[model samples]
Target chain A: MNIKEISEDRLVIFKDKNTLTIKEHEKLISLMQQIEESMMPILNVNVSYNAVTVQWDIFKMDVNDVKENIQTLIKNLDHIKIETLEKKIVEIPVCYDSEFGIDQDKFDMPIEELIELHTKNEYRVYMLGFLPGFMYLGGLDKRLYKERLDTPRKKIDKGSVGIAGGQTGVYPQNAPGGWNIIGRTPIEMVKEGIPIVRPGNYVKFNSITIDEYRRLNNDKNN
Target chain B: MIRIIKPGMYSSIQDLGRTGVEKFGQSESGAMNFRAMMLSNKMLDNPLSNPVIEMTIVGPEFEVLKDITIAVFGTEKIRLNGSIVSTASFIELKEGDHVKVGRLLDTRGYIAVDGRMNSNHILGSQSVHSQLLDIHPLRKGDVIKIDGANEASLEKKIMSKYPTVKTYKGKPVIRVMIGEDAERVKNLDSFFKESYTIQSDSNRMAIKLSGTKIEADEYDIVSDVTRLGLIQVTKDGNPMVLMNDRQTTGGYLRLGTVAKVDLPILADARLESLVYFEEISIEDARALYNEEMERIQGTYYLP
Candidate 1:
């Protein structure tokens, strides 16, 4: 493990490896949670594929002291065995009708085949960024992988499900994105003020009809 | 209460912004010009974190419904009841008074009232992220409610202009500290030697610069948590200074972060404004921060 200082108040803990497996990710998550629980001055902690960034209050502690403490914590992380963390499986209902799929024609397969390929598998939430509640999901069927649009659409509707490269996820908000859209979910991706699926959560997509999408969408609005 | 007669380019209510919430994919949305916001709030005897209306180049026109005292900072083109008034000072307004903030010479301006604004506090912040949250920016004919209006009888005083607030003229030199990938950048010297112009697309999220391509072997990095003033070098070989509304994390090579003391200057830079960069150590940056804070604390005075 290596710790690189971004600034006096922020540093990132990352391994030398290029990518991380699911098991390594769980360990990284445990180490992140431990750091958050132990450091009172830590303001926020965010994790990516194989790294964790720690931001803290500079006024409360010295940079050198914080660095040394993080080093000690890393040494201790190996001796401690962590239990399998509890993860919630969030079921998201999506409408795969060509009417909602703006870019369904981009794929070579038929609309029904596209839906089957999308809904048959479960995906894991690797991280969340780009937009609020927009999950960076892993575990896409290789057949579904496609390159992003060369010229991205100016505006993409919220809850629009799309695939780009090796990832598939839903747009949590209406914004400009480059992902190829296949379908959309009616339910709000962000409930209250928090995202529905967090880092360790699993997401399973359930196919629904266009009429069902409207009904659920209306119910959400009301 | 107040009503917006005309909502200028981009005006939104903001405070010091949210912390400890990046894990939820939330950006730290706040005032771009932190120093100006602090000055306005302090002048009104409000807490430093008090919400203020942040205005862009063009500012809003407000019709005061109740008697209140407000302070406008970082701009000189302000009018009270159709008469020009000095900015960076406390001004008392009675009901039915119309205050207009004209086109600002500075890139941004701030207006702080004496009471709490009645706005949505999602995840403990009044900062409006129209895309992420249900809140929207100020619009024409929108009514704003304040919790305790007409309360503070602030002494009418025209304060001195803060030295850190830069009204852009020539190319301003912004200082920075070493970043994690500074050594990896092949042409790091070009960042300091070349003068860049702020792109028109720049907003609260980031200020994109065009000039002097600072290249590297590769620009992608494992995404990680980002801070307020991080200077991210994109794949296009141009540098963009991450601002208040930057995402929680990004996947680009960071050259360095703008010094805490110099972020106000960056926030006040106008579109197409010339910019230069200089390097500073972390210790020096911290020292400058302390000096700026002391200057602010000692400068808050009344007649």
Candidate 2:
């Protein structure tokens, strides 16, 4: 792994590999976490796919000094003990009934079977981006894989659980999106303007009835 | 207090925007023309990061509910009580005074009040997120609260010391630094030589540029972090400069980043206007940025 100075104040640390695997993604996240703990005047540290971008305040310190410090961290990455992050799995309840399943027909299997297969496995959150609280979950069952909509929906309702190209996640807010919605969740993905989930956390979906969804949603609002 | 009589086109309150939250998928939605926003604040002795009302092509008309001092930048068509006023200095408005902002010469304008304007702080800023359902655009009849000094100081210094009010015109040449993925583009020289047309649909999220097709080996990379001025060439070979409200991560091949000092030029660029990119080294870009900062700070007056 090495770092490239993308700009005067921003640098990206990435592996030379063209393809990104789960192990490589985990390593990138670990590196990002280590960089965050190093008490450098870094403005922000972000990881996506196979790269970790570090930005510093140009007004506060010289870029050359910051770059040298980051270089040292990268060189000693192997010797440094990578902190083990706690594993947290958030259970999200979803109603897969026909009312909320706007694109259930996209799946060839029966609705009940589709729901079972979707909820059967726990998905790893690769990253959180594209939209606020939008978790990019990996590990979707091959049976549920579907291409994104040719024309994205102008607006996808908040709490809509969607699947696209071997990925499943929930929309935190009402926004334009292209994923095929399979169910709707009553729980708010974002609360008090902050997302409930974070990158490196695990997510598991639980099936629920429409009535239950309404009850939980009403309770949340009240 | 200020009451919006007519919210022309689109108007919203914004600050320097949220930081350290992009990792959570939040976009930094700040004022499009940051230099204008800062100048408006500087003229009124307010903090540079204070919230200001950013108006689009057609600006807003409002009534002053209380006496307050304000500075409007990026537009000279400011009228108070049906009389034109020079934007070179702060305008002191009394109760019941009507102010109208006419068609802006540039695509965006900023209005900063003397004191702090009350707004909810979400994710460490008051910048309205364009895609968020909860955040809203200013509407007619909305009254904005302000903790004001009640009277404008008569002995304030002239704002002539500040950068002259800008009205973008002609084919403005925007400077850029080579991007990390510059090698991906086969014909890099074509990017700097061609004149690109600003698309009508361009907004705070990104500026779409249409011109010579600069091909690349791959259209998409593994999704990566993006910066405010980063230029990404899309699948069709057209370049789009990401702006303040851009998604934190994208999958396009980047060509270069617009120099920080030149970002205000692109921000105020009108639709269909022609523009060119001039490449400079990263070191040179930093020097240009530092030079501008020193000039602004050294001459900055607060009264």
What are the runs in model 1 whose C-alpha is more than 4 Å off?
A110-113, B149-158, B164-170, B298-303
Candidate 2 residue lDDT tens string, B114-184: 89888777888889877663678799999999985535464465665334322335477888899878898
Off by over 4 Å in 2: A20-24, A75-77, B148-170, B300-303
DockQ for candidate 2:
0.68
* Per-model TM values vs. the true structure: 0.92, 0.92
Tens-digit lDDT track of model 1 for B11-71: 9999988887888888888888787788788787787778999999889999999877888
In model 2, the Cα lDDT at residue B33 comes to 78
Best by DockQ: 2
Q: Over all chains combined, what TM-score does candidate 1 have? A: 0.92
Evaluate residue A198 in candidate 2 and report its C-alpha lDDT on the 0 to 100 scale: 69
The residue pairs that clash in candidate 2, if any, are none
Worst ten-residue run, lDDT, model 2 chain A?
A: A77-86
